[model samples]
Target chain A: MVHADSSRFAAGMSTKEVYAQVLEQARTLFDGQRNWVCNFSNTAALLWHAYHSLPAPSNAVNWSGFYFTNPSNPRQLILGPFQGQVACQSIAYGRGVCGKAADTKVTQLVEDVEKFPGHIACDGASKSEIVVPIVKDGKVVAIIDIDCAELNGFTSEDQAALEELAQLLAESCDF
Target chain B: MVHADSSRFAAGMSTKEVYAQVLEQARTLFDGQRNWVCNFSNTAALLWHAYHSLPAPSNAVNWSGFYFTNPSNPRQLILGPFQGQVACQSIAYGRGVCGKAADTKVTQLVEDVEKFPGHIACDGASKSEIVVPIVKDGKVVAIIDIDCAELNGFTSEDQAALEELAQLLAESCDF
Candidate 1:
């Protein structure tokens, strides 16, 4: 039973349990809230705190955020709401992890960012990352990006849950 | 000297010195960039990391973020980029601390949010808060909000620096 005023969630829950709660809370939070700014902002906060509430490498996550297709420049992605250190403000459509997701319209589960070609190292502590594109009408509208301090921090479970979240976002948000 | 990719600043600096760097960084970050989302996102990031790099009460800050006037619903402000737990998605104009600042178009440096009438407690840990409205053409387009974990955590100096930042936001960003 989470309160509306507090972002705190039950700690020590399994990662799957946490992700499930995130989706549940997101549904409740997104109820009647069609604004992308509000939805993405809260989602970033939820993912950031959710990962921190987990154990071991999950807790080592250093970034959780979103990058939206720049309305000003459809060829690039602009920074959206996020909970992390300052990041690159914009990434070209086909460059970097976020851009790759945006360009390919595919989820990128990078086990080690250093090994990924053309990786943009925004935070030195970020060793691993996963990016999921929020596609709308067969086009990439936005991307959810999470970074961890440890290599191989995200699992296939994360990708699956986030892909589900992307679907919900596509349907729920009026972006 | 701090690197462009790293949000980490010099840790031993005074609050004033840190704020100075924040402004400098803001100028540089905002250089030729007019997108409000990118500007606000980076500004929140700078403020969050700047406070964290400081000493004592400054480092005790828990929330740093922004809220923008919703175009679809001009009577309310929607959440923006932030580096803290999830916050209230929307606050009607003239309602809470943020709204008071938005309505009054004045800097609100509340030492005790509990005593402030209509204080919206998004984070229970927030004891003090500073909200500065960014006015554009005689209307508030957005606001810069920061929350601290300790009572009386902010000083007159904080208000001055934030007000200055507000002016910069008005000039540097196109909302």
Candidate 2:
């Protein structure tokens, strides 16, 4: 059930339903996997399918992945598992959307990446973005980062769903 | 130049040319970064674009990634950075293509995965596979695993090119 066949999102599924399945599948995939590497890797793949399986905005997602808190340097976030083109290897705390999320430990849902001050363009195709910090034991462990090709690609419902997924990741991973 | 923009594979390129560019770009990407996690993650993305940028069997690739030797359990390969659906969490040495590569420290290129005894089907869509071992200090550290949708997906050229990549990884990564 943890393999790829079990992850296929059926046709005509709502975005809410898609993400719901994503969360449920992620939970099933990562149930006993405590290693952050494996968990984040599968999470990225799970998000990739969930978004592409939908229509319009969510289907336009160009990237879905994680930026883990570098153990050697907590102030910097290191690129982890991702489903996209090559990305920025490291982002300093408070530098960009990802950094802001990590520094503030709050979700950042930007309608337009270009308009976000000091945005780090990992992919030029990314028009909108969302980042949710994964907090464990009162400290940030990692962040879920998603980028879409359309402006205002994500809604508050997405944030709510992803935040719940973040909560799941916070408890699921050993990072 | 480490960003994703530089990863674009132009239209109308040969598989050999694409891989050459992949290797060149990978060297530049990994120039200053020694962490295996980042290197492997970016490498997967790079390969994803490279293969999809090509035609036929190469473009049919559904999975590209690495499975690192578990630090605590050397005989097992823990899933690492990847671009695909959720994959198997771990494969024991000599258990499958990835495992065989790790166990033998040699590249395993199978035209049809089903024909390969003891193959592990992480994705049912994967019909062919290639696994290249990254050897460090005369020991296997990790393996590059690529899966494709059609039979006879990989060739001797792919093996040679990825063997060169394995050498690059062996030298570049700390792990």
- Find the candidate with the highest TM-score and give its number: 2
- Model 2, residue B104: what's the lDDT? 92
The DockQ values of the predictions, listed in order, are 0.57, 0.73
lDDT of 2 by residue, B60-96 (tens): 9999999999898999999999998889988899998
lDDT of 1 by residue, A10-122 (tens): 86789889889889888888888888888988888889889988987999998898999988678899888888887887889989889899999999999999999999887
lDDT of 2 by residue, A34-115 (tens): 8889888988998998999998989999999999898999899988899998998889999989999999999999999998
What ranges in model 2 sit over 4 Å off? none
Best by the DockQ measure: 2
The worst-scoring run of ten residues by lDDT in candidate 1 chain B lies at: B1-10
lDDT of each: 0.87, 0.90
